[model samples]
Target: MTAPRKARSALDLATVVLSLMVGALGIWTILAGPTELLPIHYNAAGQADDWGSRELLGGGLAGLALLTLLLGGGMALAAGRTDDPARRRALRYAQLVVVLSIPLISLLIASASLSGATDISGALPVALMSLVILLIGAFLGRVGPNPFVGVRTPWAYKSRLSWERSNRLAGRLFFVIGLAGLLTAPFAPQPLGLYAIVGAIVLAAVWSGVESWRVWRTDPDRQPF
Candidate 1:
């Protein structure tokens, strides 16, 4: 098989394997995990603030595993339907992100619950989310006009220049913010670090939307609304 075909097969296999692994873990948790209430929520100081049953935790893992499969399937379908090489690549990358994230989150939760941990550090989740943001930013600029992903504004849809420029700008902002968040997560105050990252993402999104409109207004080939 060709290199691209091999790569696609590998990704497909990985998606299936990850889904099965998470699903099996969920089943195991349900069958053998602690029967008592488990800490389901944590405060900024890593103290347990809420509790839940093993079923809730196991069900969540199962749900996430199912979501991963659904997202992977949807991305594959979208890729198959699109002829644009750039769009297909972007879809593939998005699928990869979903595959990596769902399993990672499931395992993290499972580990915490099974280990009878009362409190979980907030830094890890923040760092992981930052890493995800960085990964998405690394590819955002390459994504072609698509409804499924990447800063989809109406202006961006009407103008290719708007799409490209706005996504590139957003990409840069996300990359920088993500890097800063990742670096500071371990040192910054718990909730503050999370709040700052979320706030920055929102601001970047607003800025990118405005940029799309600004560029679309000047784009010679922009489609009329």
Candidate 2:
């Protein structure tokens, strides 16, 4: 009995642990992200430079970190009572990644400077991070623990077929987008690479949403959910 109670306590305390981690990332980000004569100073590149020089880093990064924490925690807290096994697993995975990605990303960028990788830029990191997110989304779509990520929409949620179809489409779209962004950066215009990544994500979102709507419309006479 004590063991079960302890386990339940541990599960319930996940949010606290997650929040602390996010907080720490926020602090690191606020520390102005490693200042050195690297190729493209993350602090100077692509409007991240707008953060400007302050001896004490501002709260902007920390605020973003806090926002992610709140959003992730809110999802789990809001749905704690869900009886859906897939949904629970999905939430766990998403929250876990969300908690980890921000700081890891910052560390990667900082290390690039240390390693003399002057060409290291946000483009590569952004593409890589997006790919990671898409991969996680694929897993969630394949074995959903919830309805937050992947090809989420009313119709997709109603029918497993729609859910699978739309998400598979989304998965492919994201992969193509990620690949194009990664491979084209060395040759293509920087903005073009950004456009490709953003466009792919938008296209996937629109396509999945539309498919879900169309599927729902097909069963107008019958309530699918």
Candidate 3:
């Protein structure tokens, strides 16, 4: 088989394996975890403010795994049907991100829940999410115009130039934010790091949206909606 085909197959296999592992972890947690109430929500200080049964946490993980599987399958199907090689690659990249992220999130949550820690650290989750943002940024510019991924602003949909420039700008911003967050997470105060990441993401999104509009307004080839 060709290199791309091989790579696609590998990704598909990885997605299935990872999903299964996450599902298994959820099952294990359900079977072996504490039967009493567990921390289900945390404050900015990373202190558990809300409580729930272990079954809730385990079931959530299982649901996440199922969702990941469905999303991966959908993306793979879309990639297979796409005529453009670039768009197909973009879909695959998106699929890779989904495959990697859901499992990481699940593992982190599971670890915290199973540990029975009332006060967990936010640094790790922030760092992991930062890594995910960085990965997305690395690929956003190359995603091409697709209904399923990237910054899908109306202006971006109308203008290819808008899509390219806005996504590239967003990508750069997210990459920088992710890098900064990853580096500062350990040192930043509780909840502050989380706030910073959320704020940065919002800023990036708003900026990208404005950029798309601006570029679309000036694009001679922009399509009328």
Which prediction has the highest TM-score against the true structure?
Answer: 3
lDDT of each: 0.81, 0.54, 0.83
Taking the tens digit of each residue's C-alpha lDDT, what string does model 1 give over 136-184? 6776766666665677999999998999999899889988988998899
| lDDT, candidate 2, 78-122, per-residue tens | 446667766655566555544444444544543453344544335
Question: Can you tell me which runs of candidate 1 are displaced by over 4 Å?
Answer: 41-49, 112-125, 145-147
Which portions of model 3 miss their true places by more than 4 Å? 120-123
RMSD of each: 3.2, 6.2, 2.4
The TM-scores, one per candidate, come to 0.78, 0.58, 0.86
Clashes of 1: 0
- Order the numbered candidates by lDDT, best leading: 3, 1, 2
User: How well does candidate 3 score on lDDT at residue 34?
Assistant: 89
How far off is residue 73 in model 2, in Å?
A: 3.5
State the local distance difference test value for candidate 2: 0.54
Clashes of each: 0, 6, 0
